[model samples]
Target: MKHTMLAVLLAVVMAPGLALAHSEARPGAPADGETLSAPPEVVRLNFGGPMRITVLKLVGPAGEVPLARTDGMQPVTTLEARPEGELGAGAYEIEWRGMGADGHIMEGTVDFQIEP
Candidate 1:
């Protein structure tokens, strides 16, 4: 019983730290699994804390698409990018990798569809 009690105490003490360690940035615009009637003007990411985006890619039905970064390659709480050209109707995915405020490498993807 004493061992079990200690284990419980450790879990309670470590829970918040573990949660923060696993925290990740989330898509702010053109949200994950979203379907839109038209293309979004910009792609945005919202981070729980400041993060330096290392790589950002936009993939469409045809192939890889190009983007113009508004946030540059710097640490920011919010990051934005604009597509260089108009997007046609199809599925799209935006993948990103970054160095989180905690100095850990973090990555995520946002999937959305453009309706014809």
Candidate 2:
């Protein structure tokens, strides 16, 4: 009973720290729900922790747009991406998959719009 109680206490104490380890994108460029009169030349994803992006894509009104990954893609705090062509006025979504510093695979999406 004593051993079991100790284990439970440890688990409770560690849970919050484990939860904070999950990487999350915060304050992204072309932030969620933002509307712009002109398209942004580049998109920036800022994370709360270090991460390595493996896949990044952009889906626009016309369809999936070609996204080129820029530098700063290592296990840094940010990842940069740019579209191959100019984006017309419309809604767009940026999807990304990556490995967190904790060795966990994580994915996220950001949605925004280009105003007409």
Candidate 3:
């Protein structure tokens, strides 16, 4: 009987911690609803798991600018790039594909624009 009691107590303590470990992108990226003026220097992907970014693309005037891995970050979940060059003005679409430590590839986008 004592052993069973101890096992029950142990499980009660560990259950909550396990739940917090797996994080989710709530609502959506660019966080469901967010506004911007000019295209963000870098498209940020914030997630609960450590995600591996596989693709990045920015579509705007002139043509589709492939957003380099270096969008707006040096390290630790940052894209190391900036919106530059002769890219024309207009709303831009930022698309990205990546994987999480959970072994799942999650892709999303956020649209921030440049005014006329």
Candidate 4:
């Protein structure tokens, strides 16, 4: 009984940390696996807590697409960036890496397609 109680107490203490460690940013505009008739002017991400985005890249058929970040390099709940110019119809992926509120590095990609 004592061992079980200790285990339960340990779990209760570690649950929040575990949750925070797993917390990651969710796709906002131009969601993952989204298909659109036209190119999106801006890219966005919504985070559960504060995150400092280190890298944000837009890759298209031609290769790396340039983007103008609106959020700069800072901790934020929502991050936004605009493509340097109008994107051509093709398959695109937005890759991002950031430091979470818990100080862990998290990275993800959002793939989208623009119909020709």
**lDDT values for all models:** 0.89, 0.88, 0.59, 0.89
lDDT of 2 by residue, 1-116 (tens): 99999999999999999999988878889899999989999998998899899888999989998978765567868887788977999999999889998899988899999999
Across 60-100, the per-residue lDDT of candidate 4 in tens digits comes to 98889899987769888999899986688899999999998
Better of 2 and 3 by lDDT: 2
Every model's TM-score: 0.81, 0.89, 0.58, 0.85
**How far off is model 2, as Cα RMSD?**
1.6
Best by TM-score: 2
- Kindly give the stretch of ten consecutive residues in candidate 4 with the minimal lDDT sum: 18-27
Evaluate residue 79 in candidate 1 and report its C-alpha lDDT on the 0 to 100 scale. 90
lDDT of 4: 0.89
Error of 2 at 108 (Å): 1.7
Checking candidate 2 for backbone clashes, the offending pairs are none
Which run of 10 residues does model 3 get worst, by summed lDDT?
Answer: 71-80
